[model samples]
Every structure is written in C-alpha cells, then in structure tokens.
Target chain A: MYGNAYIDPNEVNKTHSVLADEDPKLLAEFEARIERGEKIEPKDWMPKEYRKQLIRMIEQHGHSEIIGALPEGTWITRAPGFKRKLALMAKVQDEVGHAQLLYSAAETLGKSREAMINDLITGKSKYSNVFNYPAFTWADACIIAWLIDAGAIINQVANAKGSYGPYCRALDRICTEESFHLKYGHDNVVTLATGTPVQRKMVQEALNRWWPPIMHFFGPSDKISSHTEILMKWKVKMATNDDMRQQFLNMYVPKIWDLGLTVPDANLKKNETTGKWEYTEPDWDEFKRVINGGGPCNAERLAVRRNAEERGRWVREALKAGQTAYVVPFA
Target chain B: MNVAAIKELLYKVADDQLVIGHRNSEWTGLGPILEEDIAFSSMAQDKLGHAQGCYQILHDLGEANPDQIAFSRKADQFHNCQFVELPNGEYDFSLMRHFLYDHADQIRFEMFANSSFEPLAKLAKKVKGEIKYHVFHGNTWINKLSTANEVSKIRMQTALNESWNYALGIFEAGNFEAELKNEGIFEGENALQNKWLEVVCPLLEKAGLTIPEKSSWEPVLGGRKGYHLAHLEALVAEMSEVFQIDPTATW
Candidate 1:
C-alpha cells in the first residue's frame, strides 16, 4: 500500500521554469499530442521540463513502493495464522516487485536506479509521508492494506491514464495486483471490526492512529496547491488532491461505516450540494513537518533503507561486474 | 493402517515448514538485495502454503482446523526440527540453512511421491516439483557464496559448521517410524538421512566447503518428540501474539 505522490507545497512555490522559455514548435507538438491522448514513448521528443517533472514524479513513486513495504512487511511474521501469514508475504513481496517495476519505469526518463536510491537515502528525494509513521499493530497493517492501498489504486488508476508509456504500463500491472490487496486487507479489517470486542478495539485504535495520515495522504486541498495548468495539460498531474480525496471518501467511507467502525473525524461527511467531502482540515503543518523528516518513523525508515543499501552494496557491485549494457524494456 | 504414525509424520513435516517458512519471511525487507528479498518471500509463501496443505490433511483426519493447530499450539507441542527453529542471524546463516534444509525437503518429498498412501503420494508429486525449484535456488546461492570471496566463503563455512548438527536433527524419527516404514507409508528416517547426506555432501565439496567428520556428528534428537531448544518458545510466542488476542476471531 502506498500514499499519493506528495506535492510539497514548497515545490509549487518555485517559479514555473518551463513557461519562461522553450522551443515553441517542439512544445506545441508535445502538448498537442498529449491533448490527443497519445502516449509519450521513451524515445520521443519532450520538453526538458516535462522530463524533469516526470523523473521527479516516477522516482518518488518508485521510492514510495519499496519504502512502503517495511511497515507491512514487519507483520508478515506475526500475522496470526497460515493464511494471513502467506498472504502478507505475497502482498509485501508484490510491493517490492512494484518498486522494481517503477524503478525501471523511472529509469527510462534518464536517471539510474542507483542515483534515485542515493537521493532517497540522502533525503534529497521523498516518498509518501504515510510510511514515516509506524504500523503499531496487526490491525494497522490491515488498515494500510485496505484503505491506504485503496487510495493508491485511485491515484495509480488516474496516473495509468497518463502520457508516459512505461509508467502507464507499469501502473496497469500494479493496479491489477493492488486490486487483490484491497480485498485481502478489507477481509482482514472486516474480520477484526466485526469480531470479538478486543478485536474490534484493536482495529478501531489502529484506524484512529492511521486516519490522520490517511487524511494527509492525498496531499492538501487544491485550493491551496500550486498552479498546475501546464502539468495538467502535459497529462502529468491527473487530478486535484481534493478531488481524489472526495472520490475516496465517497467510495470507502460508507464501507468503513457499514463495518460499524467510526472514522475518528466527526465532520467527515459529504456535502451533498457540492458533491464533495467536508471535514476538519488536516493539519498541513504536521504534514509539512513529517514530509520534511520529523515524523515518528522517518529516521528509522531511512536508516533501515540506508543500511540495506550499504550492506547490499557488495552484491550489487558483484552483479554489475563485467555485466553488458542492454537496452531496457519500455513496455 | 497406522493412524498415529501418519499423524505424527504429518505434524513434524507441517511444523518444520511453518517454522522455516516464517524464518524465510523475516528476510523480506532486509535481504542483501531486493531480488533476494523477493526470492526468499516467494519460497516462504510456498513453504507456508505447503504447511497449510499438510494441516488440511490432518484436519480431515480428525485434528482441529488448520488455523487452531497452527496458531494455538505451544512450543512444546510443536514438532518442527531445531534447525528450522533457530533465528535467522544473517544472510549467510539463512542461506546456509536454506541450502541444507531444502535438500532434505526435496528428497523427503520425492520419496513421499511413491508412498503407499495414495493421497500423500499425490500431494507429494506436486510438492516435490515446488521443492525442486527451492533446492535449485538454494544450491545456486550456496555455490556462489561459498566460492565468491574469502569473506562470503568464510561466512558460509562458519554458518554450515554451526548449523551442521541441527540440520542432522531434521531426520529424527518419530516413535512409529519402523511401523510406518513397515507399512511403506514412510521409508524411515535413517534411509532419508543417508540420501540427504549423499546429495548435500558432494554439493558442499563442489562448493569448496568441508563437511564435519563423522565422529563429530551428533544429531540433535527429541524435536520429533516435542523437545526443542530455547529459541522455539520465543518464535512460537511471537508468531501467535496477534492470533492469541482473540482466537475465535475470524482474523
């Protein structure tokens, strides 16, 4: 399960560098094709700014997947029984496989996987902030697998319709597997929510703990987000943050309610007239702080990832030794 | 038919897979490489699913359901070998254990493929095919790491030495082994042990690793009779920590 690609409010604050200058003829062809719903292949001509934004988005997304595995991966051992145990391992392993796919997808845009990983461990690149918080219980893993993955499916489905050929293909495959995880996670959460009192309490507490991060998941409301008319036109930014969040609440809030679990937000309900969700504003300050590396698990998560990179450096080196460079598959 | 013998055989194999499968899964996010992590997890899922299959057979034979038998049992009641119960200390140790255990598993399941019991024989055919891949994966790593460099070779050798006796314990016979052998339900532990050694020794030699001398081999027994090292209780407890919260809950 993953959170949406967080657009740092600060990143938008930067001046739109692409709008300042570019060869107008090449830019026109790129925008016109995107307008025609054409996929931009790896070998195609694209504006420098298009390449930069895509690299940033896909690399952060790839980083989110592998880093996202850590928390749920912890529960694979203590996952209650043979069924849950096997399912969790397969599920977590799928997330790592998604990382591999996303990394290769990101690679087509010119940055190497090694470079992206380095940026990640060095805190230059960012993953979803939701993983920076701990999964404190089995119930938390369930909630993440169910609700968080649901959010990712929404985000990824939107992005799968995107213009980049490799990333869209990768997302198509990812969404198929993610559909299974949603069922698995929902079954797990439902088992707890409608179970014995202790089981219900455990799930309830886990949901309460995760709700804040879930709220922060889709990023801040677009009303306060950056001007992205260009990116939207480029088929990069698919939907506004608020629109995705509303869609999620519309689809899942009733499911959570049907399970007889409270969502922790009293004001979390649809504004029928506007056809949007109305709720307490997520503390964007906390979101900013966490994304900037102040959340409970950020240090530990990055440390673990760094240690893995360092320890595996030898194996990675061994693999590259005398290895021939082949054309990477874009499909 | 020796019902007690079949049940005993089933429990030991099932427990071994469960424990080792759980250990393999511990490498999920912490493997030396992402591919290795995924490899271990794939094998882990297969092993765990195999355990559930064995438990389902037991369930059909009047045992409690698979979940209860797997989750509610204490360490003292588990029949897993001590080799599988040991903590995964490092990649080298885990890899060595995988190499050792999978060889024995492949042979055991292959033997079971011709068992007198038709159901077990049918299951064994499918399981043996899966174990063949597992053994291949283990052999590739063992061969590479054992000859890769001085450090990896030293680590693999050390892990093999430390785990040698525990690996032998995998063939500790149950009380009805002779009866099961007589019935052709199992071919007996001694026979299994001989085949395992025959398969693993040459592979170790080819990997440039030494097998400990015959006199030094003291197979840790009693695990088949529910005895275990200090590690089993902790592993069992950790595994069931969440399940014990509400055993009747659907989760």
Candidate 2:
C-alpha cells in the first residue's frame, strides 16, 4: 500500500533540474508525466515547486485536523447520554490522531512537528476554513460529524492515490476512522430528526449555520486560482477544487434531503442533462476571509490552542527529561 | 431507607465521577503528544460515561432525570470528595490523581463485581474492563514521571498532599457504612482505605515522597448527601443549560 509506481529516471532528473533552475523544458516534462499518471516517491527527484506546493497543502491539512477538535470538544461534558459522550470523545480523539498521521507525513518532507506547530501558532500557516466556525450547541456536533467530516472524506478519497507515499498512507488511516465518524454523525442526526419537534429544529439550525462553511471547504474553484498550475503539475493535488466540491454536493445533498431536512441552499438541484449537481456558488470573499483567520470563532480557537500549549510545557519537559533508556511502544 | 439517605448516596457517587472525569478531560488536546492525548482523552470519556451511568441509576431510583441529577444539583448537595473536584493543576498532579483513583476504583469495582445488587454488579463488570486500561495509563505515567527530574517529583508530592485527605474521603462511610458492609453491598470503607494505603504508600516512598500521617479526620459529608462546593453549580449550569432550555424538547 505504501509503495509507489516507478517513474523514468531521466524524467526524474529533468524534473529536479527544472525545479532547481525553473527551466520551462523540465516543467513541460513533469506536467506530461503527471498527465500520464506516475506516482512520485520519496527517493525520486521532483521539481522544487512541486515539493513546496505539497508541503504547503499537506501542512495545512495537518493543522486543520488539530484545530478541528476544538469545536466538538466543548460539548463532551454535557452530552446527553453515556453512549453519546463516548462517541463524541472518540471522534475528537480521532481528529488528534489524524493530525499526528498527517504531521508524520509532512515530516517525511524534512519539516519538524515543532516548526509546523510554530507556524500554526504564529498565524503563518493555513488550515481548513470550516474549522473556524463556532459549534454553538450539541447539535452542532452532529453537523460537524455529518457535514464537515463528510466534506473532508470527499477531499481525502480524491487524494487517496496522491504521489507521496506517506501522505497516501496517512489518508488511508484517516479514511478508516472517518467512516466511523460519518456513521455516528448520521445516527445522531437521524435520532434528532425523528425526535421531538424541538430536536428537529436544533438539527436544522445547526445545518443552516454550517452549510456555507461546508460548501466552501473545497476552497475556491481552480478558475479563481493562483496555485493550480504548479500544484497540478507536481501531482500534489489530483483533482480541481470545483471537482471535489461537486463530488461532495452530489454525494451529500441527497442524503441530507432524504432525512426530510431542508438544505440551506435554495438553488441546489440535480441536472438531468449533465448528470451533475447545480447549486449557488459559495461566496469566495467569505472563504478567503475565514481562511485568513477572520471567521467568527477563529480568535477563540487559536487562544484556546495557545493556552493549552503553554500550560502543557512543563509536561513535555518532564517527559523529555524522563526519557532515559525508554522503550518505544509497539507501533 | 429515607429519601434523604438515597439522595445522599446517589449524589456522592455521581459527583465523584463527574469531577474526576472533568479534571481528566482537561488533558484533551494537550497531552505530551498526540497518541497520549487521544488515550488520555479516552480515559476521561470513560470516566464521564461511568458518571452518566451512575446518574441514570440514581435518576431511575428517584425524582430526577440524569441531566437534572447531574446538572441541577447544588454544589453543597454534591457528595463527591474534594480530591476529584480540584483543578488538574499540572500533568504531575493529574497523573497522581489518575494513579491514586484508578487503583482505588479497580479494587472497589472488584468488590462490586460480586455485589448482591445485580445491576451494580453488571455495571462494575463492564467498567472493570475500561478501568484496566485506565490503571495501565496511570502506571505508565507514574513510571515515567517518577524516574524523571526533581521537579516532577516535587510537583507530584505537592499534588498528593493537596489531594490526600480528599482521596481518603472517597471511602468515607457516612451513614451507609454499617448497612452496606452488613448487607455486603460492596466492600467496607475501612477495608478499602487500608488497601489503598497499602498500595499507594510504597509507591510514594519509592518515588521519593513521604506519606502524611493522619489519625481521625472529619469527612466532608455533603457530596453523598447532595451538598456540594461552589463549582458544582457552575458546572451543572453549563452542562444542563441546553437540556433545561426546553425540557420537553428532544436534544
């Protein structure tokens, strides 16, 4: 599963030299190789631009996992039942685990976990904008599970065949755990939808608040793009932004409608002609603003993370000092 | 036998679990590393799950739903010992509490595993499995922290001092001592306390800390009796706010 399909050695050399020197000929060869579908491995030479783009995308994905825990964590204490509490806790834990896997993948590119965390703390990095929205109530947990995770799974599944071996491996693990999250969220939402009218209202309200963020999760379409050409040529991203967003809409919009709940988008519908989903495009400016740390709960989320990191400094110190001939746990 | 007695017993168990669970949860997203964060958070979730179970039992036996029992009870009415209620001051303190409580809880659950009360026994049987992992986690942290620097040792000792009396209070018999022991409802408090000391004192000594001496101590009685500290009210307010907003509504 972790193995990569081999690429031509001369092509690898050309790609590296092109990236190192920004030669147009090498870029053309690299783009042609991607067009022909070859998996890039760690030992394989790659364009410098490709390495930079992959690091940026992968690091941002990792940070999103870390920050994503904050929204659902607020309700752990107040979950109505034992089962619900356990499930919420497990879901939050899974996100942290996902972050670890992604960070390790990023580390394969010669970046340290400390540096990534520092980049996040100093607001020099980008995570998914969806995480910046507030989880206002317990139902918001269901929405996060049902909608946010669903959106993520769509993106991840598209990237499952990514060129990087480590990133694909990490995505594989994340996808398995995410299946559990998806089921749990659907269960929660179903219960609420079938429960008292008030419960139904809570679900709807949460959906209303979360809809735009979920739609924007794929980022702006490639046409509005800046990094598309470099990212695509390097095989760092396999699908266009619009393609992933459309796939998400096609998969989830029907599921939401079947639950007898109203989706916030009035124009959302299936087109019989193109066999594709049609919906109002999300506000790209809002997407830009939210990702730039301007979302409603962005400041609060960062503050919480910073405080916890600072408070736990002593624990790390103690563990580091205590690591004398320590045995590593079995992987 | 009286309503007050039943309320007292229920609140005591529920509050202890809630406080300990809350303190344990503070480690979420902040463990020394990611895997440990997930594991620590899982333990905290298990504790909260157990607390919710206890509250459900109490609610069924009396006048409130689990939420009402957990969130509406006044602080003074909460019967949890002060030990579990304190903030998780640091990793060392949190680890100490886990080490102490998990050990005690394992032994306590072992006794309940054979309880005459079938429901309690069954619950104990389920909880015992989860507690096993908790104990392992506690032991892991203890071994790591004890062999570390003088700072960890110092922090652990101070945490022990602050929590020692309250930890002992976990086994405080209150009015149920004789009936519970005579009926074999569970193990007696004194036996449990002595067993706890036997297990804990040696560990503390090895870790370069001294166990404080105590003769007779006045137990903080209200947690079991439903009297709680000020924090319980705030905790309950936050926990139950959504449920209480529209009681008839399904959340």
Candidate 3:
C-alpha cells in the first residue's frame, strides 16, 4: 500500500535542487509504490516539486476548458435547426462543466478559484493553444467537436488513472461527459460528409485547418524531460508526450481515413511492424509561438474574457448586498 | 384546427425558444464563474432543444423542415416576443430574464404536463425535469444577488425593471389561446400568468426591488402572427447561412 512506503529526498539527484532533506527518500519510496501499481491519495506526503508540477499541469488544463468555450459559443445562434442548436448547446455546456470539475481539482492544491481566474485574466496562466484559433464557419463547430474535443478526451482518459485522488476523480467525470461531446462531433461529421458537395467541401476545409493544431496538442516530446521522472514516480502521468501523441495518431488517423478525408500531413501513415503511427512532426517553433501568446486569435479571445469579467463586476457586487425590493402582485 | 392557426401556435413556441436560447447561450464563455458558465450553457441548450421539438412537430404537420422553419423564415414570420430576443446586456439582465422566464415556464409546463396533445405533453414532461434545474439555478441567483452587495442589488433591480414589461408580454393572448384552452390543448394564459406573478412577486420583493409601473404597459403584437423586430433578420441570416447554402445537404 502507498501508506506503507517511505522516500528519502537526498537519494535522487534532480535537475532542480531539493531543500526538503526527506524529499529524496520520500520520492524513492513513492516511486517504488508506483512501480507496484499502488494509488496515491491526497493526504499522502509527497515532494513539494511533485505537487508543484501537478498543479501547473492540472491548472493549465482547467484554464483550457474555460477558454475552449469561446470558439463554439459563436455557433449557438447560427445552428441550422432546433435539434442542431440543442446539440451544440449541450456540447458547449459540457465544456463549461469540465472546466468547473478541473478547477475544483486544482483547488485541492490549495489554489483559490479566484486566484486562478486572475491568472487567466492577467495572462499569467496558459491554456491550450488550439483555442486561440477562430471558428470562422459553421463547419468549424463540427471540427471542434470531433478533433479538438477528441484530443482533450485522449488526455483526460489517461488522467483518469493519474496518481492524485481529486484529479483522477475529476477526470472520471470529465471523460464520461466528454463521450457525449465526441459523439455529437462524430454525428455532425458523418452528416456533413454525406451531405451535398458544399457541405463535404466545408467539412474537408475545417479538417484541414484543424489537423495541424490537433497534432500540436500533445506538446513537444523532447523539450519536457526534466519533470517526467518525478511525474512518473508519482504516477501523475502514465506515458511520455511522444507516446501519447503516437497513441492519438494511431487511433484517429484510421478514423479520418474512413471518412474519406485526408489529413494535412502528407507523410502520415501507420508502421505495421512497430505498431505505431509515423507522421511528420508539427512545427515545434509555431507551437512555441502560439503558447507564448502569439497565436492568431489570442488577443481577441483574451479581450473578450477580460471584458466579460470587468463588465459583470457590478452584478457580482449587487448580489453581495442581500436585499429584496420588488414584490409581485398576487393572483 | 386550421393549418394557419397551427402554424401560428407552433411559430410562437419555436421563436420564443429560439430567441431565449440564443440569449442564454451568449453566456457560454462569459459567465461570471466556471460552474455557472456550464449551468447557463445547459439551460440555453434546453431552450433550443425545446424550440426544436416545437419546430419538428410543426414540420411533421407539413409546415417546413425544422431548419427552414427556424432560419429561412422572414423576421416578420417569427413569433418570439421581444423579451426573449433582447441581447444579454449584463449578467443581471441575463439572470432576471432567467428568473422570470423560468418561473413562467414552470407554470406553463405544469399546465402542459396535462396537455390534451399527447406528444406535446410527453415532451413537456421530459423537458420539465431540466426546467426544474433552471428554476433552482435562477432562484439561487435571485437569492444570492438580492442579498449580495449594493452593486449587485442595484444591477438586479435595474435588470428586473427593464424586463418587467416583457415578462407581462410572455402571457400575451394569441388568437389560438381560446381554441387551445377550449380544446384542452393548453390551460388558460391568464391563470398561468396570474400564478407566475403571484409566485414571482414575493421573491422579487424579497430581493429588494419594486415591480415596474403597469399603467404604461401595452402588449406588443405579431410575434405570434409572424411579425418580429429587425433583429430577427440578422439572427436568422447567420443561423441559416450553412443550411441555406444547401437545404438538401445532410447537415
């Protein structure tokens, strides 16, 4: 059991120095417990660095959920029929709910929800760069449901088995709700793909625009080695970035091909012998540029969010007063 | 019922839901907080879903496809009241609309749960489960905002004042109200309206606001008869852009 394990901080030499004398021993014992397939609970003693890494990863994930709504929210009014409108609305609602669940998980790390909001507003936090792009057409909505959410679900499903109790629990809920999102997307894609020539063209165009970003969703594999050892020791992450990226490609490439849609990457293919997907790597420089606040729609998206918070400040304050003035006339 | 009358009734329900759903959806990424953002989005979805249900019924009755019925219809053909179509100017405005509409819908759906039209009644019952959450959310905000701070109280008051007249219009009597009530298609609008006021007045009063003056109130007609404000045109245009591109398309 995890409770029975002990770690000595000094034993493991980390790139970053550890001040906690007991941290190295604790990490070793923690790693041993993980190798044995034990679960890590919230109250267990862990290295401060492990907690910090988890918070960074989990909080960014929470921010992504909130920001993710902007792209699809634009379509609620323009949805074709009542059924389509309702479906889109439900999907967007799920994104918001996912954000709530994720934020609650981050709160377990002793961060206030208010503080998190401020971080996002002040540009001190990071969210998924994919959201920084615009949803220019109705077809983009379907794309978001299929590709964007599909990417999110891949990471979330992996997190469902993460070490932290709160995070894993939150992931469980998020993954369940996300299935509806994926289905909604899949339904729309199928409909569009089978529709008239114009719709097919629209769906294809949307796929073209989204393919590269989806590839980048896994982040850079080589640039993120420092924290992997510790994260693995804690069982916070199940696989490497490259492994997860390959997994995503292997699953989705065939599905896209079945739709008769070509992914933007001409070199995309499956390696039969290795049982892995071999695809051209996305532009790592562009990924860095986007994450560093240089994406196409980043400014506009952030402005909208900041403005909403500012404009709604009065209402929040009004609700704080606690008084009732208007009385309805009885029947 | 005559085809024209059926079409008019269906339009009123569809347009009302579409407009209200749109307004609610505007809060998708902009809600005050994360959890509330999701809650608000869910409510918006429900409204759209209900609207679509009404549209589908009309289509089955030979009106048009739900998409065309929703998007291709001219502004003058829209039957939504002005209250539902107004922009979500502020959170207070949005919340007040939610509070009033949710209260009215609860009463409306309760009457509808026993509708003579079995299909409508069954759908109403299904929707009522979610509406319960809307009412709960609205009531929670009403209580929270009413007692919150001076600013929130003022904002809520102002929002309530702005929405008061439109709230009255939700009960506006269309030509079919008599026939609908007579045939047991629905309960009387006056009774539902009265119950709405009775239920909401105390809550509003307790929240530190006064109902607006009614002397100047006048029912704006035509949303039930395919007449609408200019906003409906632009809304429909954007909404139907994709569908209109190829009406026969699968999407």
Among all candidates shown, the one with the greatest lDDT: 1
Tens-place lDDT digits, model 1, residues B27-93: 8887777789899999999899889989998998999999999999999999998999999987888
DockQ, all models: 0.64, 0.50, 0.65
Q: Sort candidate 2 into its docking category.
A: medium
lDDT of 2 by residue, B133-211 (tens): 9988887777666767787777777877766766776777767676666666666668888888888788778867767
Candidate 3 on B1-251: residue-level lDDT in tens? 44555566667877888888887887888977666677787888788788888888887788787777777766777878777877787788988998998898888888888988777788789878888999999998887887777667787788887888877878877777777887777776688889998999998888778877778666555565566666777777777876777776556
Clashes of 1: 0
The segments of candidate 3 whose C-alpha lies over 4 angstroms from its true place after superposition are: A1-15, A19-25, A223-227, A315-331, B1-6, B114-118
On TM-score, the stronger of 2 and 3 is: 3
TM-score of each: 0.95, 0.87, 0.90
Alpha carbon deviation, residue B46, candidate 1 (Å)? 1.0
- lDDT (10s digit) by residue, model 2, range A1-331: 0101111223344544456686678667666766777766655666675776577677888888888887777887677655676787888888898888887777767677778888887888777777788888888989889878887887787787767777887888888899899998999999888888888889999999989987777777657654444454556766777787788888888888888899888888889899888888889888777767788988887887777777667667877883578432211
For candidate 3 chain B, the 10 contiguous residues with the lowest summed lDDT are B1-10
**Across residues A228-326, which tens digit of lDDT does each residue of candidate 1 receive?**
767788998898888899889999999999999999998888888988889999998899899999999999999999988887775565455446895
Residue A147 in candidate 1, Cα distance off native in Å: 0.7
Residue B111 of model 1, lDDT score: 84
